[model samples]
Target chain A: MNRGFIYDTFNVVQQNKIMLVYQGEFNQDIAKSVLAMTERNLDFFGEDVSVKRKIFNVMVECLQNICKHAEHSDARLREAIFMIGMDKDTYFVTTGNHIANEHVVGLRSKLQEINQLDKEGLKKMYKGLVSNDKGLSEKGGAGLGLVDLARKSGEKLLYDFSAVDHCDTSFYSLLIKISKNKIIQ
Target chain B: MENLTIKATDDTPEVSFDTSGVMILSGRSLPEDAASFYNPLLQWLSDYGKSGVTNPVVFDMKLEYFNTASSKMLLDLFNELESVAKSGVDALVRWYYPEGDDDMQEAGEEYAELVEIRFEMLTY
Candidate 1:
């Protein structure tokens, strides 16, 4: 990793009004602290209570996704990255983690499926999953997190995947955007 | 069954179930190990189901936020209650949301549509 590149990225993040960023192992303790910091930051910025709650809900889902699904390999692979930022009236929550390459196809397809649904369709999907006796994955995920994120944000889920060198794993990044103006609708 | 009460934390909700047939769960629920946190509650509900509760059971859910795992556990809880209701025990679910929080309201509505028990939406 180039030292100058890290500095440049820091500069870019600050310029973009990024609220919070973390790159480390995500456990219960870290999740709690990150949530607290995010809450305080939202209050400091005087975001609307409804908007703040939406961002907070999305943050919890993203963090739990990292903790539950991030592929464990070496110490570095165990680490995940999360960032929350705002541009204009829209808030963005993003998370990136290492995942087994074999899992990428299913995960990508899930995201696409969620992105294709409108609000009503997402609601129906959520109810159907919740009522399905066999919906829970082996990881204890009900597979509704992405759908919930999309429904709450009222926006499509954006994602990207890249292969990691010398390993059968890839870095998966997901982004959710919540627009203040569209929230009331 | 004796009443069960678990205080809320940064990531778990406060749970209160009275023998008088009133249940209340409020606050955020984002537990790291959702099974560890919700298993006991599920067991309590199971016991309640067998405890000859003929009185009207009221469930008040005022959750601010919950993760996907918690959502699954919640569904399980509601399913248990639905069975109890079907067995001739009067059961009612009151889902509360903060004024202007459409997502939370929608969450309650979705749960209502999934289970067979009666549900009412309240704004606070």
Candidate 2:
């Protein structure tokens, strides 16, 4: 579909209060759109500078994760799916992507570990993981981006997995939210 | 005394370090090749330390997003700074994370715990 169509369609779905969503192929263009939408939403919703930067950072991390880990080898198909929205009290950012069931365990473990940690604990965990001399792993869960997102939001991650086609493939959706007041502060 | 500058890309940020009197690496750093990008920078810091500058060396990291390997490099970088601090030369490390980004702020604290330097969190 065309960019205007996609943007309008997303705009319609999010008309009630304040929201933005995009799907299909995440490239530099999509990244730019995401940035634009975020800035617009911040302006409409009265987001402070620091909060806008935090949201921007979170979106970049999520967009990069989708680009880096999508199961689709096709470059065109890889850069797809992104959404951002904000209502009176909260701003929500969500992205959907395809992945294999085998990778879910690793992703879950990482999220679980991050979810359990308080601010201090997360920092300690991040340090230990980074300092470990074992080196990098091929797949995800190096504890870098995930930790970064968790630290930025200071909110528990909301996520779900839906079976796609057969058991091997699944659609994963992740949501991040920040309170409007907190953004002002 | 060395000057290092690398442009930022979609996945990374610009880096600028000056070793004229103090050692400083300031800017967003999410390089594709974390090790390769940081190796030379770390080497310069090492050499400066070995040169016996005896002056306070400062490292300013204002990174947005860094992968696991990059995180490790940062740890190594700060550890080297800590070593220089112990060697009689004053070492002061400043970490800036947007005030609203608790994650980055906490990251500065984490590095503070692991390294011997006063880590300050700034909202930028």
Candidate 3:
């Protein structure tokens, strides 16, 4: 008997202690549902209020990044994948999406720039971006989602981009870790 | 114009704009379409501006969590209030954060830095 990709993915998620996995078209409605589910899961686990808030903040940015950046494939196909996993005292939030090849360079550079920054560096950059009148993106993002994710999680962003079979496209995956002990502020 | 009052929902905040020159926004604000939800609030601000609120407009913001989209809308709101203040009406913002939530506190501080309004931070 042979297991398919779905089976392998499931196995990997379970092995990684993923508490939730969502793969499909991501829109605002779906984001709301996912947040609600995470909220309930956090409550059930008796997580502290501040921990829950941190996770929720990071989750919003991750989901909205998918909604704002994911390449549109077939209207019905899965455009992205999101997962929340916990290992010991750390919780990991990961989002994977397809992007046009043309966007790969810019996205990679931006992530690299963010990864290189310390917390103070990121904070200064965030303030600069927010205050710069000319910095607003067409999507109204101001390119602050990733920065906020880093600032809130207080962790380096882990990301990867790989070429896909389809021409001019690649799959982009981003992982952020939040510690239970570092709750709030 | 009539005062505006919107009840809080899981994804939206409770908003109250009284004719007495008081506005309060409390609860979580993670609306699906933040623009749609905030546009009316902005419009109300415009109306309040024209109404010539002689009394100081006190805005109490006690939000636990808000998404990035809401963050942008908040800047817009503060900018509007700044304009209203410039027009000779006193506008003040009281930003409330949980005792230990540094992120929220920092966020409030950031907003204060971006706008010209009189912004004060309070811990709950």
Candidate 4:
């Protein structure tokens, strides 16, 4: 499917739309490029104030995750890929990154945990996790971010894990939707 | 000892820590590169630890939003400060969050739990 068609399908009411997608090394250079592209896409799509802020927040978290967690040791493949798009109903944020097979079980459990929590439950969990005096393990160090995104979206997080290669280099995708009504036009 | 000051911008936070009596880091910090931005700050805290300043070092952190990488950097910063506390320098770190910003408050609490220093949550 064409990317433009995908974007247009979502733009039922809004005259314009925001869309950004990139596939590259998950390093400082790519992070900056994604940031710039995000800003330009917002301007081109005529994003509202609140949407802008929300998008910025979401991007900061997602891109930073790519930089911090994506399995970049592979000399062969790019570490991460991501997309941010919008329409009248909601703004869509998605990120895809490489994860070793060893990490998948834990990642699945974490997302499932977030998916199972009610708004209040997630809020409390977020508070509890923050209040707990524990050092950052490679996994949970960035676990808070996933919880943060789920809580803010007020929706069940959408995700999928698929094998990218023979040796368990899986590709993980995360999607966040922001309601149009909530945004300040 | 001289005071260190840095103005806040859209991407960076203002940092001002007084070496005289109270050491403070006040302002929003959402920098581009957490490591590069915080390296010197970490060094400063380490240096303060070696200075033998017994007075309580007040660290005021009023951040709106910080990325995960920055969170790691923050952990490093707090770890250094915790070491200072262990060395018997009365270190008091204050995290100031705007009223109703639960995220910042929770973040402060997180640091408090992770570090041994005297950390307080202040709302403005």
Question: All candidates' lDDT scores?
Answer: 0.87, 0.70, 0.86, 0.72
Candidate 4 C-alpha error for residue A168, in Å: 2.8
Candidate 1: the clashing residue pairs are none
Candidate 4 residue-wise lDDT, A96-120, digit = tens: 8878879999989999999999978
Clashing pairs in 4: none
Arrange candidates by lDDT, descending. Answer: 1, 3, 4, 2
DockQ of 4: 0.27
**Between the candidate structures 3 and 4, which one is better when assessed by DockQ?**
3
Q: How do the residues A42-154 of candidate 1 rate in per-residue lDDT, one tens digit apiece?
A: 89988789888888888888888887887686888988999999988888999999999999999999998888888789988888787788846777777778888888888
Q: Residue-wise lDDT of candidate 3 within A1-185, one digit each (tens)? A: 56698899889988999999999889878998998999999999998888888889999889988887875656533479999989999999999988888888998899889989998899899877766655335664547899889899989899999888846678889999998877732
TM-score of chain B of each: 0.97, 0.85, 0.97, 0.89
In model 4, what lDDT does residue B71 have? 74
Better of 1 and 2 by lDDT: 1
Candidate scoring better on TM-score of 1 and 2 = 1
Each candidate's TM vs. the true structure? 0.94, 0.77, 0.92, 0.68
RMSD of each predicted structure: 1.9, 4.1, 2.3, 5.4
Candidate 2 has a DockQ of 0.43
| Backbone clashes in model 3, listed as residue pairs | A185-B102, A185-B103
lDDT of 4 by residue, B1-124 (tens): 5667777765567777778646555554545465677788888888888887887777777776676546777888888988888988777787887666555676688678777888888888
Clashes of each: 0, 13, 2, 0
- Deviation in angstroms for B20 in model 4? 4.1
